[model samples]
Target: MNDGWISDEEERTPQVTPVYSQTFGRGGGRGRGGYGENRRARGFNSRGNSWRDEGNSGGNTQRDGGNIGGNTWRDGGNSGGNIWRNEGNSGGNTWRDEGNSGGNTWRDGGNSGGNSWRNGDENITTLAVKKNNVGRIIGKGGSKIRDLESESGARIQIGKPSDEDYGMTVEVTLTGSEDCRQTAKRLIEELTDDSAPRSYGGNSNSGNSYNVEEPQEEKPRYIDFAEANRAYEEAQKERWAQLPPLKKNFYIEDPAVAAMLPEEVANFRKVNNNITASYALGQSPENSPIPNPVQTFEQCFSEYPEILTQIYNQSFTKPSPIQSQAWPILLKGLDLIGVAQTGTGKTLAFLLPGLIHTDLQPIPRSQRGGPNVLVLAPTRELALQIEKEVKKYNYRDIKSVCIYGGGSRRDQVNIVKQGVEIIIATPGRLNDLVQAGVIKVASVTYLILDEADRMLDMGFEPQIRKSLLDIRPDRQTVMTSATWPEGVRRLAQSYMKNPIQVYVGSLDLAAVHSVTQRIEMIHEDDKIARLFEFLHDMQPDDKVIVFVGKKARADDISSELSLNGVSCQSIHGDREQCDREQALKDLETGDVRILVATDVASRGLDIMDVTHIFNVDFPRNIEEYVHRVGRTGRAGKTGEAISLFTREDWSQAHELIVILEEANQEVPHELYDMSQRFSAWKEKKNEDRGQGRGGGRGRGGGRGGGRPRW
Candidate 1:
C-alpha cells in the first residue's frame, strides 16, 4: 500500500451492514502530471449484477479460492467468480493498478433498496465496471462483497480474464424470479445515480475506450422554463387581444403543460434525492444514507496554522467542501480527484495542505528548484486568481507568482529567480518556461491541476504530459475541476496513484443552485434591441456582466452599447493588457457595470458582488457556463444568470443541462425535455443574433496592445 493509504481502523461495528464500497480511487506519488479534478478511469469489477456510476460512485476488486480452475488473481478481477481471497506466495499477486485518473473517495451515496428479489426468470442484466476498481469492491477478508450480496439479495458476480488475456471482463449472471429482477435493476440503476454515463473521446479518431453517443445535436431546440412560460403567455395574450378584455383560459395549445408535469406527482421523489437529511440516499438502521460529516476551516487551521499564515495573513474566510474533505487526505499525501462546481473554493482544498506540508517539512535551503509546491491552472485568468489568493495567504514569508501567456516572458523569468515558495501557472506558459530552462520543477513535492477537465478540453494534454507529469514521477498530487470528462479522467488515471475522490454540490443540477436563472429569447434580428431593453430595464446600481461569443463582438457590442448611452466596456484578447486590467478594475470599482467579453472572463476570476450575469451569447461549454455564473453569487450572496439564446443555440443549452445535471443542480421540470433536443434547432438560431466577428480579438481574450515588459 505505498504507505500513503489510510489503513482501516481495527474496530468494526458489530452486526455491520455491507456497503457497496466504490472509490474514486486516488493516492499517487509526489510531483506527477496526475493532479486536478475527479475523473474515473479503469475500475475493478466483481461478483453478481453490480455497476458503478457517475462521479460519486467508486469501485474495487479482489479474488481467491473458487477461481475458474486455476491460479490466484490481482488487479482487474479473478479468472472465474471467486476473487484471489487468500494471500498467496506468487510474489504477492501483481496489483493491476488503475491509470492515474484519480482515486476514489467515499461519499456514502445511499443504501440499495435491499437485495432485489430476482426470480430465476429470463430477466438478464449487464453490470459493467471499470477494470481497475475490483479490489475496493471486494476489499480484504471477502467480507465487503458478502455484505453487498447479503444486503442486496442479488447474486453479485465479478469476472476477469486469465493472465493470457489482455482485456478484463466482469459478468453478473442472474437467474431469479421477476420480483428479484425488478429489485436488482433498481439497485443497479442507483449506483451511478448523480453521474451520467462516462464517454471517452479519441485522439484524431484513434478510438476511445469509453463511449456514450456524443450528446446528440439535439434538434427542436431548448428553451428555459421562463422562456417556455413567456411563449405561453405571449400566445395567450394574442388570443386575449382578440377577445373581450376580461376573457381568459383560451384553451392551452402549448404541449409543454402536459410535458412538464411532475413525474408521479408526489411518489417518493422517485430517482431524485428528496431525503437529504442523511449523508447520501437510502436509509438503514446500520447504514445511514448520507455521511454528513463536517470539516470546518478553523479545524484545518488549528492543525496547520503555519501553513495558513504562510499563504495568507488571515485564515480562509470559509471552509468549502473541498477544504473540508481534502485537509485530511492531502495532509496524509493521498492522491485525490475532487469534483465540484466552479468557485466553490476547490483551490484552497488542496493548496492549504500543500502549503502546510511545506511549512512542516520546510524544504531546506539549497534543495533544488525553489519551492516544495506547484499549482497549475488551465487559464491565465485562473492561474492569476490562484496566485492572488495565495499571495494573500502567504502573509509575510512565503512567496509565489502567477505565470501565464501574453505577459512578458522576461518578467516571468525574473520572478523565477526570486526563489518563489509556490508557483501558480498555466500549462502553456509554465511549459514554455520549463523548456526554456528558466525554471526547474524537480524539487517540487506537491503538484495540483485546477480545472483539469477544461485544461484538456482546451488542448493542454500534451503540455501536461511534458511539464506537469514529467516534473516528478513520485509526488503527492491533487487535481480539481468543475466537470469530470472522460479525457480528463484518462489523463488523471495515467498520472495519479491510489487517490481519493471528492465531489461537492451534486445535489442539484448546478453548483450554486441558489442562483436564479432566466432566459430571454428575442428574434434573432431583434436581439440587439432586446439586450438594450434589458439594460434599460436594469437598475443603475446593479453589477452586470454581458458575455459574447467572440472578442471582437465584445468590443463591437461595448461600442454599440455605449453609443446607445449605456455605460459599458469590453475585455477581450485584443484589448491592451493594460486596458484589460483597466476594464476589470473599472468593473470592480463600479465605473463600468456592464463588462463585455468572451470565455476569457469565464473562469476562476472572482470579481465579487456581481448582481447579474448576461449571457449575451450562449456559452461554448458547460464548464464555461459554471465559470461565468461563478463570477456572481459569490461570498455568500444571491445572484442571477440571464442567458440569451436563439433557436440555434439549443445544443449549447443542452450541454448546459448535462453539465448542470452532473453537478446535481435541478433544471425546472419544463426545461428538461427541451434541453435534450437543443442542437440543430438552436444551431440556425444563432443567425437570428450576432455579437460581432469583426476585426480583432486578443489572446487574453483579444490581443490588446501594451508595451512588452521585456
Candidate 2:
C-alpha cells in the first residue's frame, strides 16, 4: 500500500514483553489470561485444549499446540473461537496462533482498528481505509456488513476516521479464527479498492467483487438569447456586403428594333420612372406615361427578330390583350403588375423580357456567379409547367431548372452546381436551397412572383418574403395574378416599384367567354350516374378534366369511371410527384381520356385541347371556379363546362349565378328557386332570434323600429 493509504494508528510498534506457559494433558486443558498494555503472551499445549488471551493497548498474544489458538482484546470489537481471542484499546495489536486443528480470534476496540490475516497461521494486523470508501465496506443499513460476517465467519467492525489523519481515513478491523480472517480481508480490500470491478445496485459476487455507485452528471447552464440573435444578424450583414453590386436600367442592344418605335417612345422611356395606361385599373406616380400597346408580333419583339421568328413559328398570329400592353412596359425596363385570367399568355410576357434582360446585362452570363432570374411559384406542378414553357423559346442558349419539394434534392443540387441563368422554383424548396448554400440569390436581377394571390391563399407568404431577402431590391419585379385581391396588392407595394398595370379583361371574377357554361340541378346521390351519362358523350379524340373538391372524392370518381370501362386517372396533393407527372403525361399522350383532380390542378396548368370540364364537386369558392373553367377554353379554343349543383351548395348559389350571368350562360329555373328558398329560411331564422332578443324589433322585421344610428 502507498504511504498515503496508511494512518498514524497503523504505524505503531507494539512493545512486546513475552510470557510463556506450558500445559500437558491427554484430554484437554483450558486457560484464560488478561495482560496489560504492550505485553506479549504465549502458551504451549500438548493435547485437545484451547488458550484464550486478552491484551490491553499495543499488546500481542500467541498460543501454540495441537489445536492452538490466541486471543487479544483492545478497545475494539469481540470474537470467540476454538483457539484464540483478542481485545485491544487505543493502539495496534498482533496475535498469532499455529496449530494443526484450531482457530484464532482478534478484536480491537481502540480509537485505531486491527486487520487480520492468515498464512499457515492466524495473525492480526491494522488497515487504513479512505473515509469516502468506508460506506462500501459497511453497505446499506449494515446489511452488507452482516452478509460479509456470515460468509467469511468473521466479525467486521467499521470505526470512525482516525483523529491523527484529520478524518480523511477510516479504520476497518476484522477478527476471526484460522483462514476466515484472510478471506474477509481480501473481500474488504476489493470493496474499498478503486480499481475493483464494481457491480452497481446489486449483491456482491461470491468470487471476488463489490457493488459500487456512479456519480451524477452536472446540469447545463443558462443561455443569453439576445446576444445570440445579435451575433446572427451581424453575420448576415457581412455576407450581404461581400456580394457584388447590382446594375440596373439596361436595355436590349438591337438598334433595328429600337428604330421600329417612334422617337417619342425612346424619349418617354428615358424621362419617366414609371409606366401606366388609361385602359388599366391601377395607380402609379403622377404624370407617368403609358406606353402604347403593340398591335402585332412584329411590334412586340421588333428588337429581337429571332424571338419574333420563334413566336411566329408557334403560329401565334397576334398578341393577346395582356401581351400587347405587358410587352412594351417590361421591355422598357419598368416593373409591372399584369392582372389577367389564366391562359392569356402571361408566361411569355414575363419570360421574353426576362430573357432579354438577362442577355443584355453589362456583366456576362458566365461572370454572374449564379442564376440571374428567379421565378417563385406556389406549387411544384406550376414550377414544372413554367420550366416547360421556358424550354420552348430558347433564346441565347439560356437554360432553366425547376426546384421544388417532394423531388430529388440531390439531383436538383447537382443541376444547380452546373451554371444556369434562370431558376424556376416553388417558394418552400427555394428557401431551403438558399439556406443550404446550394443556390445563391445575390445575382438575381429579374424576379417573377407568379400566381401571387394563390400563393398567399395557400399560406406561403412567409416563405416568399424570406426568399426575397438576399435579392437586389432595384431589380425589375413582375407580379401576375388571376385576381387582384388586397393581399396581392400589398405584396406588389412592398416588392415592386411604381409599376405599370396591364389587365386584359375585367377585374371582377369572370370565367372564359370561349367556354359554354352548363349547370345541372340534381340530388346528391344522383351525381355518379349523371357523370357516367356525361362521359358517354365524349368524343374519341376529345380530352376532359373533372374537378372535385377533395382528394378522396377524386379517387372515388376515377375508380368508378374505370370500373365502367372508361379510361381515367387521378392527381392530387397526396400522390407522389412521379405519379402526378405520369398521370398528366398519360392524359396528354391520349393514353387516358379523362383526368379527375382537385383544385390543385386548377390554377396555372395549360393542358392543350381539353374539350370539357366537369365540376363533380363545386369549388369551395368562386375564384377557383373561374380558374377551373379557364383551363379548357384556352388560347382562343372553344370548350364546354358542365356542373352538378345540389342543395348542399346553397351558400354559393348567389355567387354562381353572378358568374353565369356575367358569362351569359343559361341558368335553370330550379337553381333560382333553390336560391329563393335558402334566402327565405335564413331570413326566418334571423326573425325568430330577433323576437327573442329585442321584443320583435329587428332588421328582419320589415323596417321596424329597433334603434337609430346618427
Candidate 3:
C-alpha cells in the first residue's frame, strides 16, 4: 500500500506482513479467523471467497482470541479447504494462486513487501532539447533514432515542433531501464552540444555537429550625417598633417654672371619656373662644399667659360628651372636626382654638369681607354638620344660613344677599344660589354640613370646592378625622370649617396602644362575614321606623332594612314635597328609628316617642331599617357595631344580625370560620368571583398589595365 513514490534503488527489497481473513472490509476489526492484524492497518486488502486461519503445528500461523463481526474459530482444527503458507515471512510477497477451473492469477492487492516491478513498465523520462538539433537527433528518415533505440533498448518519442518565437525547446521522451535511459541521454547531449548560444564572431566548439542554426547577421552600424562629416574632416586633417611642407621660391645664386632680362623674358621664366628642389648631404666633411644655382645658362657657364661658347653656338638662350637648379649641384660634383616636366631641359641639366666636369678635368690618353663617365638609359632610342645631346655639347677633348642592343656589338666593342671619356649606353648592352671586358667602369666617376623608373619597369634592375658592381664607389650618381615613383626613390636610397632631389612643380605623376589634352570617347571601330578627320584638320607643317597600343596595331595603322594619303612611318621593337632609326630620322626631317609608334617612343625621343600627338589607342596607364603627350611639347613649345578612348578604358577613367583636373585641362563630361560609375563599382567591389567575396582587378593585369611600359 506504500506505493506513493518509490525509487529504483529503494524498491529492490521490501518487507511485508501476512494476513488471514474470511472477509475484508474498509474497517479495523479483529476476528477469530484473522492470523495477523494490527489496530491501525493502513494496507491493501484483496477480495476473495474465504480464508481460514488455524493453529496447526505444521503451519506457521498465529491465531487471535478476539471476535470480529461476530465470527469465531476453534484452535487446532483443520478445515475442509486447502491452506498454504510461505515459510519464514515470505508469505506477503507476490503470490500466484492456481485455481482448479483456470490458470494462475497474480493478485498484487496484498502487501508487495517493497519489491519493485522488474518489467520496467514505469520507467519513463522526458528531456528538453534545442529545436535546431532535433533533425540530428531524429537523423535522416529516423535512421539515427532507430539505431539509438536498438543500441540502448530505449523507445524515444519526439514531441511537437518548438515555437521558435517564444524560444521553446523540443521535448523528447525516453522509456527504458535505467542504463538504457542514461545511454540515450548521453547520445542526445552529444548531438545537441553545438546548439548552445554563442557570442558573435566566436568559433563553434562542438566537433562535426552540423545541426546548429546559423547565427543571425548583425546590422551594420551607420553613422549619422553630422558624425560622418566630422569623421571625414578629421581624416582629412590627419592626412594633411602627414604631408611634407611645400617649398617656396628659393633659387640658387651665381655671383660671377650678370644679365639684365627683358620684361617679357622675365615674365616667361616666372610663368614656367614652377620647380621644387630638396637637398640632402651625403657622408662628407662637416664643411663639405655645395655649389650655388644659376638663373641663366650664362651664369651656369661663368666658371667654365668654354661651355659658354658651346651654349651660344647651339642657340640656347636661358636655362630651364631644372637646369638652373641642377647645374650648381652637379658642377660641385654632388649626387643629384632630378625630376622635372618632360621636355623641360632635363637632358641638358645633367648633360651640362657632366660636360663641365669633363672640361674641368681632362682625361689623359692613358686614362681615356675606360670612360670616366657612364650614362645608363632604359632603351636604345633613349641612349642614342643621350649620345646626341652629348655630341651637341661639342667637348673636343672629352670623347663619348653611344652603345646599345639591336645594333652591332662588335662595332660597339671596336669603338670602346678606341678610347672614350664618356659612354652612353643601355643597361643590357652596357652590362654585356662590361662582362665581355670591352667596357670598364673602374675608372668611371659619374653614373647617370636616365628614365630610371622605366629601366626598373623593363626588368633591367639586374643589369643596372651588374654595371654598378665594377664602377667606382666614389662616383657621383645622377638619376633623372619626368615622374619620380616610389621605385625610383628606393633606387636612389640604395645607389646614391644622400642625393639632392630637384623637381619642377608638384612631385606627382601628371602631364606637362605646355601640352593641351583633348579626350574623346569613341568606339574602337571608329578610331581610324576619327584619325583621318583629325589629320585632315591639321596643318601640313605640323609634325604629328600617333601612339598605338601594340606593335602590330602600329604597323596596321601606319599602313592605313599611308593608304589614306597621310604620309606616315611606323617604328616599334620588332623593327630592325637601321629601319627604326631611319623611320625616326624620316619623321624628324620633313620626309614624313606623321610618325606612328608604340610606347617605345614615349620617352627620350626629342624630335624638334612636333606640334601634335594622336593616341590612336590609349596607353596602358596614366604615366605612359603623360610621357606620350610629352613627346610633342618639347623645348618649351606649346602643343596639342588628342586621345581616343573606348569602353575598355573605363577602369582608367578615374585616374584620367584626376590627371586632367590637376593639370587644369578641361575634362569631358563623358569622362567625368564614367569616372563616377567607376568609383561606385570600386566601392561595391571593396565591400564585397570585406564580406569574404572574391575581389576583382589585380595590379598589372587585365587588358588595357596592365602596368604601362615604354
Candidate 4:
C-alpha cells in the first residue's frame, strides 16, 4: 500500500475462533416416559443462560447422564419455551427466537472488522472530501481519500489550491493516527478502479494531510503577464513537438463555422488553438447546450414515477438538459462540470443526483453533516430555491438545508448540528461554518458549484477558492452557469475533470426566448413612466422583477408601484438578512411577487416563474444585461425582458448589442436604429464642437473638451 491505510487480507491469515463452553440444559425439561423419573431431567433448575449450538440433532433432550456440554433440541424448530433466549455473548453461534420466525445461525466468520465498517442500509457517513486530481495522490473527487476515511473512522482533507497555486492541490490528511490512516489507504489501493500508484506525501507518509510543506530548492524565475503568456505559448509548442499531431483539428466537423474564426483560432496545427480542450468535452456552445432528453418540467411527474410517489406529486413533465447530463454522471459517482444559463435547472442537475445517491443509500444522521450532496450556489436566493426544490424531492428520505450570507448564524448552526442529507449554500456563510468548526467539509462527497460564473465574478472569487480548497478533492464537482466567461474557462481548466461543456443557449444569444424584447429610446426622465406603463399592463399573477441602479431607486420604484396599487416590495443592501430572506420567501409564496431589487439579488436569485424582468437600470455592460434578463426564461419557461433606455442608458448598452452581434445572435432592429441614431447625434455634437473650436482658434483654441455621457 502507498500508505499504511489498509493491508491485504490474503497475505495474513486471521486467527481461528476460540471456544468457551458453559454446558447445561438448566430448564431443559422434566420428562420421563410419563413416570417423571428421568434422573437426567436436571430441569427445574433454571440457570437461564441459553446458548445455541448447531451440532445438536434428532430433537434430543439431555441434561445429565450425558456429555460435559449438553443441548436440548426441541421439535418444531425449537419454537416456544425451549427456543433460544438471547445470544448476548460476543458473536459466535447467534440464534434468536422472535415470535415464530427465528433462525439458529452458525456465524462461521470472525469479527471481520472490515465488514463492521460497511455503510449499508440507511446509516451512512457523509464524508466531505476535497476534490483533487488523480495520478498525483488521491483519485478524482478524493475517491481514494473517501475509502481511507471511511475505513478508519477518520476525516480526510484534499485541499485544491487557488489559481496562485497553479492548479496543484494537496492530498488526503487523515484525521486520526497511523492505524486509522493505514486501514483507509489500504482500501483505497484495492477498491479503486485505478491501478496506478497511490500518491504519497506527508510527514508520516500515510496518504493523508496536505500539511507537509516541502522546502523549496530555489526561487523560481518570474515573468510579466505578457512575457509569461508568450512563454506559456512557446512551452505548449515544445510540449506538442514531441508527440505526433492529430490527423484532424478539434475533431469536430463543422468546418463552415470553423472557417469564420480567426486563422490562428482555427489553426489545425497551432498547439494553443488547434485543439487542446478535453476530449471528454462535447460541443454545447454558449447557447443550446445539450438538450436534456429525459423529461421536461411538464412531464416530470410521469417520468420519475418512484420520485413522484415518494416526493410530493409536483408536476415535472419535462427535464432540463443539465439534469439529463448530470443525473447519469452523478449516479456513477463521477465528477462533472455543467455549463448552462441560470434558472435552467442547474440546481436540480446537481441536487437531484445528490438526492438519489443519498436516498438509495442512506447514512447516519450524526455523520451525515447537513447533506451527503453539498450544493454551492452564488447567492442566498438561489440556495433557497435549490433548498425548496429539494424539498419536493424529499419523499426519498433525504432532507435539504440552505446556507448563505443573509441568514441567521445561530439557526444555521443548530440545523447543521441536527444534520441534513443535503445542503444548498453560498461560499461566504459556509466558510464561516467551516472556520468555526461547526461544519466539516471532509464529509462532503458530492459537490455542486452553482452559478459558477458569478463565483468567478469579482469579490466572490476568494471565498469560492477558499471554500473549494476546504472541501475534499476526492468528491464529485458540478459547476453550472448562465454565462461562461474567460474566467470560467480558466477555472474549468483547473478544477473540472475532462468536463463535458453543454450549453442550453449561448449567454449572448439564448437569454431572450419567447420574450418580447423592446429597446425604446427615451430620455432619463421618461423611464419611470415607461416602467409604470409596463406594470399597468402586467396581470395580477405575473410576478415582475424590476432591476434598478441605485438603492434609492429600488425603493422609489417600489413606492411608485405600491402607489399605483401594484403589490410589491423592495430589497437592497440595507435590508437585513432576515428581511431579504423574508422578501424572497414572500416572492416564492406569491405573497409579494412584484418586487424591485438592486444587483445583489440579480446575480443568483432564483425567483421561480417570474413572468417579466424590467431592466429599469440597464446593465452598464452587455454581460450584465445577459445576467439581468437571465432571471426569466428559466427552466424552459418563456419570459419577457423589457428595457427602457434613455439616451444615456442607451449609450451604455450599445456595446452590449455589439456583443450580442458577435455571439451571432439577432439584434432587434430598434436597438440597431438606436445605435445609429446615437452615433449621428454624437457626430452632430462633435461637428458643432469642431466649428466652435475653429471659431475659438482665431481667438484661442481651448485645451479642454467636454466628454459625452455615452
Which candidate gets the maximum lDDT versus the true structure?
A: 2
- Against the true structure, candidate 2 reaches a TM-score of 0.61
Task: Please give the distance, in angstroms, between residue 460's alpha carbon in candidate 3 and its true position after superposition.
Answer: 0.8
Ranking the candidates on lDDT from highest down gives: 2, 3, 1, 4
State the local distance difference test value for candidate 2.
Answer: 0.73
RMSD of 4: 32.3
TM-scores for all candidates: the values are 0.52, 0.61, 0.60, 0.53
Per-residue lDDT of 421-528 in model 4, one digit per residue for the tens?
787788889787877888777666667777777776745777766666645544566777666677877777666665665455444434444455655656678888
Model 2 bad stretches (over 4 Å):
1-283, 686-710
Error of 1 at 388 (Å): 0.7
Candidate 2 lDDT tens digits, 137-158 = 7778887788878878877867
Residues 565-657 of candidate 3: C-alpha lDDT, one tens digit per residue? 778899999999999899989988889988889999999899999999999898888889999999988887889999998877877898898
Query: What digit string (tens of lDDT, one per residue) describes model 1 on residues 1-710?
Result: 21222123212212112234333435332221122212222222232212221122222333222111222222222121111122223222211222123321111111222112222223445565445545434646665455445555665556553344455634444333455646654554443333455332322244644645436555785759998899987886665444211111111112322233344312222222221122111223352111222234444455455554553554446565555555555655666787777667777677766666665553354454466678888877678778877766653376788888878888878988878878888888888988887777766767898888778888998987888534555667788877767786787778777555667645333647657667565446777777778888888778888888887778788888788787887888777666777788788888888888888888777886789888877776666777788888875688888887665555455666665565456565434545544443344334433443453342433332221121
How close to the true structure is residue 373 of candidate 3, measured as C-alpha lDDT? 76
**Which is the better candidate, 1 or 3, if ranked by lDDT?**
3
Error of 2 at 5 (Å): 50
Question: Given candidate 4, what's the lDDT at residue 350?
Answer: 68
- Model 3 weakest 10-residue run by lDDT: 65-74
- Model 1, residue 578: distance off in Å is 2.8
lDDT to native, each model? 0.57, 0.73, 0.69, 0.56
Candidate 4 yields a Cα-based lDDT of: 0.56
